[model samples]
Target: MNKENLFDTEDILSEGGVRDLFEEVEVGEGEKIVKQGDAGTDLFIVDSGQCVVIDDKGAGRIIDSLDRGDVFGEMAFLGGELRSATVRSNTPCKLLKLSREPFVRFLRKQAVPGTKFLIFLERFMVERLRKADSLRVLISGDQDLSGKRGLQQLRADIRARNTKPLLSADDPILSEICHWIYARNDQVLFREGERTTDLFIIRKGEVVVVDEGAGGFLLGTFGANDAVGEKCFLDGKPRSDTAKVRGNAEILMFTRDTLVELLERDSSMAIGLSLGLGSLLARRLSMANRTLRLLTYEELREKAEVSRLLSEMRKSLRIKTLH
Candidate 1:
């Protein structure tokens, strides 16, 4: 098997890069590197020996194996949540670890590269989710239900009635993956920091995005055809913001299993989907960068408050380290 490079020589040549940030650590055989449900802020990359990723739910099934260059603990590191799985060294292992604060600092200093890194990480996470979902399908012996007549009936109805259908009737890839859901007013679709495998598209009514870090602010209201949960779904992390229905609503849900199956059958469709999502990510990142270029007075005040919070957090971390 080919090994993965954590950082290229060019990246290492740059001052204060990821190569300079990670610290080396050694683990004995049968040692647990990370425990499921424990909050983790560091990401680890295996340098040598072997490790195993095990899901602790119901008798501890082994999800995957990690050899040289494999990375773990990234989901919790990126989402600021508890670990989803346990990683244990199968043999004496050499590892490189990078903590959250330094990673954030590196990103701040290297904006363009950092954005590309995030995209790479998102792609990696998506592959991992697909593998997990596919494994579940194999173990359960579940049949693919995409050939159901109900979906064809729904597609026909959408074509005749809806002027702007979320997926075209001819798009078999999407047709196989999408299913309808109903939601009532004030119903929570998903809460912040909750892990989920499904993505949604609103077919009717609206939903509000509530972000607590922004002081319970309603970031925006999304209406028909708007996609929610895609960002975290793509990144394989917990939801970053809470989504609640504003009124009676119809939604279309898509699962990672369907997408993986689609890719297995048709590679071109997968490429097209990735390209479309990649462009959306690029536009969103550009807009965010533009917003950071100019801040209002209130925005400036909020920024200062964020800095103050970070200061307090650093002090708390220091105290913990001392003890």
Candidate 2:
């Protein structure tokens, strides 16, 4: 096997001080690097070749034809989640595989800046997931249940649930707040730290919450009925995480100044918002933990079964494909 270059000083392995753990492996055409439903223990960086990603529906989608300097398999490494998709070679390929132990060790030892970089990478991946979700909605013909609900109804629901008053037409803050509408597949929101002047509330459809993992693996997903960008509004801190459209989404946006003014005048409104945010965070953490456990267990079971079946078939079959 040809040892292709895995990392330079600029790569994550280098930054994490685990650059030596990766070694190159050459693969033939049609070679399977990682199969679906496997417990991913290593991440592969493509040095050369085209890799095809196949989903569960037998739909072979080429997410990206990875070339030199592209990384894959990090999702499983970071979260201990099952492989959500399969990767196969389309041509003669060379890749570098980094095992989990050294990878984790590197992360644990890395300095704060390196950790922050990993977090940015995790946030970037989450943003990509949002884009993927939006694309799915655009291609699929599913009716959006939330889209059918009128804005007035959504507003009424928010008002009825809150002890404090919702924004009224006469509220001075309303004039300063701006609304940005993202149709299906629009990147309507962003993670914390993304420089933007808007705070968003889901007016329609759903938004996903993605935790930023500085130089580490992405945390997970957060679904609809979630509010985002409130942290930025409260302390002017960079976005803590990313928010994206789950479907055709409409968002109520407020500028920083307007939000601050509202908070100053209506301390009750601010308190209620904080409480709501705390609830959302609690629910999100719970969901993430549950998903991690479920996905990891499922992946372990599936990998064992697949490995056994593949071994049996390999021993039993002598026939070769004509194609």
Candidate 3:
């Protein structure tokens, strides 16, 4: 779950020929491995020693430390975006770099290993997403829960006509999971902390996830072909948010046990489905990180305003004393 000690490098990288897939880079202490705001096209694994992920705003703050077998620069494989934070060598280090293009080719060629690596990556990002979500709440004292448009855009990207969504297509394999059911308006699909492993894929209309942990703040709004409650389904963890039908909606509801049966029955279908879910998870994590950064700056602004108010209070008291 935590980034460190995530992969058994030899087992994961070597078994599937993942070891040959990455190009190794050696760095001197204090060397920059990734620069913030630069286009990220590769994911990195700490092969030896350590690296520090740092915030690039003013005096850099260390976000996290990467020890052997840890992953960083993963935003690259999740799909291209500017690097959110900078990673630099904390000591002389060795890193394995995995570029997007070659990794895709590797996945196409190998089946099970690709699925295995993707499952590993999905779990890793989920942990990161939860950590970032908690940090945002800590800084703001409440979750902002105002990124409806942004979250929708992420789902749209996955469902673009030309794009294959991270969710499985409605096929024999998918039908085994669940069939479409017309859910009514005001339907409570699931609640936070409820024991449910159902993965919902909206076919028509809207479903919104409310963070009951944040007093029912709107966490995410998802629509057609968008997967929801996937984090719980993937990790077999309890639901962290409540999902409700915004309008009379049609959706496909699948259970984790059925999915596991599919995995056992057909390796290729299972891998493809899992990979798609992994991609969707990556998109969600990306949005979560960006939102956390904005929250950080927002907290700074509030602190400055508080200081100014204190200064004005002091001046007003001094003037009243003189009068």
Candidate 4:
């Protein structure tokens, strides 16, 4: 069977530039654009030519590739982690590069196009993350992990994940437009593949995302101030994971239409809200990448161990007369 590239990107962007917020950098063929474990938090867009994403662990392997308009280096750009993969230029290329510091300043200076760009990035990142998680589950299915509740993600501290609170205590969305929800424990907020456009922020209590297909594989557990389904809020795609209440919880819901209306009425708040969504999605995507890397390494080791044992067993089964 063909190996599916888990990093499926949303092909919604092909602009000359995102309001000229990015700087163009030239690269030559076979040049390593970004290296794994490097301390770089800058994102790059394939302006022209191609590049390959390589997992620089052990013997190393190619994870994916990028062409015009595709994004790379975002795992570190959003997650504040070291570069997770090495990107090498396949051809002499021109890349549009932007870091968080300048991206924020551009958003403030030109809110309209900047907001649109931020919204696009947030949605794109969500799609990218969904593909990564989808592949993770598929890989786990290869081995009978029936009793294994989850992959290495379970050991990670939920409160200290790459996801950050989308808003603070004084955000206006909490006051004017949010639909307050008081949910009971074990209540399902939303299910995977459901068509819903509601975005939820946990006001008090915990929310957990689960993959019911894997016999309740825990995707993530989010605490107060974290967003449960921010992706559904922007992209009209079906929900990727089911969100359930862990306890009696208070959730603030916002409809995309309502947010659009509010942004139209008061453009001043656009930069803050839109950028916040971008940052939140960036961190979530970063976490997903890290999880993917961990899962990949574990799977590799498991396969190597099985091969070694099989070889030993074969040797032991040889006829004594042969010796």
Q: How high is each candidate's TM-score?
A: 0.42, 0.43, 0.75, 0.75
**Which wins on TM-score, candidate 3 or candidate 4?**
4
Q: Write the per-residue lDDT of candidate 2 for residues 147-228, one digit (tens) a residue.
A: 4334335334333443322233344545455455655753747764676636566655666565444332233332234456
Best by TM-score: 4
The TM-score ranking, best first, is 4, 3, 2, 1
User: How do all the candidates rank in terms of lDDT, highest first?
Assistant: 3, 4, 1, 2
Those runs of model 3 whose alpha carbons end farther than 4 Å from true positions after fitting are: 1-15, 136-164, 168-172, 257-272, 296-323
Q: Give every collision pair in model 3.
A: none
Let me know the TM-score candidate 4 reaches against the reference structure. Answer: 0.75
lDDT (Cα, tens digit) per residue for candidate 1, span 1-323:
00122212123323335457779999999999999878877878787888887768526977578777666766556545467678899999998888877766666555334433444545554443333222222222333434533534433432333234334425765666667778999988888888885677677888887665445655446677555676765655677678899879988776666455544565445433433343333323222222222222223324544344322311200101111
lDDT of 4 by residue, 247-312 (tens): 799887767655565555565565666666666665665666555545533544356543443223
Candidate 1 stretches greater than 4 Å from native: 1-16, 129-323
Error of 4 at 153 (Å): 7.4
CA error at residue 167 for candidate 1, angstroms: 26
| Evaluation by lDDT, superior candidate among 2 and 4 | 4
The residue ranges of model 4 lying beyond 4 angstroms of the native Cα positions read 1-17, 142-158, 161-164, 169-173, 265-270, 296-323
**How many Å off is the CA of 80 in candidate 4?**
3.4
